[model samples]
Target: MTGITDFTVKGADGGSVSLADYAGQVLLIVNTASKCGFTPQYAGLEALHRDYAERGFAVLAFPCNQFGAQEPGDAAEIASFCSLTYDVTFPVFARVDVNGGSADPLFDRLKADAPGVLGTKAIKWNFTKFLVDRAGHTVARHAPTTKPEDLRAEIEALL
Candidate 1:
């Protein structure tokens, strides 16, 4: 019965961030990578964050290097890339492993709550998004190919 609110994640500044801080907000938790083919999604994600933030929506970015070493930068580098490249204003968390034994606990719960296609729990690639409701429960899992702009309808529904 554990939800995302039960987990704690680290911010890009290496500080602890409680998911509880985001209570009552719809969250689009995305696994990001600066050098991946989906890297441009950062702009779309930023757009969503800006467009719906006042409506209690947020885009939480978590950079990961687990996918083909696509995100090999450190915290500073990741933050800089996000800022300089996409002007991302959303919360970009510390890099984390989104799959395998070393995966972050938050990701573990997310994948379990909303498994991938065909009931597979393994994340297929970066930019994979997990949408969480206001109550911190994961609602849906979007594939790497799913563009952020295409998620407006679902986000509006949750709002």
Candidate 2:
């Protein structure tokens, strides 16, 4: 099966990151935006990372500008803002489009694996999250309104 570990994503440094590197880890993959109303969710996401990392859990962030031009910064700028503003330690990837023809293939697979409300394949907004189990199976798709902390029990179950 074409799981998340089958894809290669762009790193913040413009390098390719093999998703295989994260194999066996429970992942909360999120599309983020610095200027969005849900920006503060970064802290909650970081908390999830810090709290559950030793248990093989992680939060992988991908900044996207496709939603309202909310993330207009470059890679460096995005990295700096994430560090200075939220002190996030999780892996924050390069900017990407999460919907439409230009969407990243990883996200495309994620959306296909676990469609949103009404079986929608397109990501609706920034901070949309996909939870993946250790086997790389997409477990759930969360909307921007779902708080990170609210996922603790689900993550713990996978761990």
RMSD for each model, in Å, please?
A: 0.7, 0.5
Compose the digit string of candidate 1's lDDT tens values, residues 1-159.
766887899988899999988989999999999999999999999999999999999999999998899999999999999999999999999999989999999998999999998999999899999999998899999999999999999999999
lDDT (10s digit) by residue, model 2, range 67-98 = 99999999999999999999999999999999
Which regions of candidate 2 are displaced past 4 Å? none
Which stretches in model 1 have alpha-carbon errors above 4 Å?
A: none
Q: Clashing residue pairs, candidate 2?
A: none
Pairs that collide in candidate 1 are none
Q: After superposition, how far is residue 154 of candidate 2 from its true place, in Å?
A: 0.3
Distance from true location, Cα of 108 in model 2, Å: 0.4
> Each candidate: what lDDT?
0.94, 0.96
If scored against the real structure, what TM-score would every candidate get? 0.98, 0.99
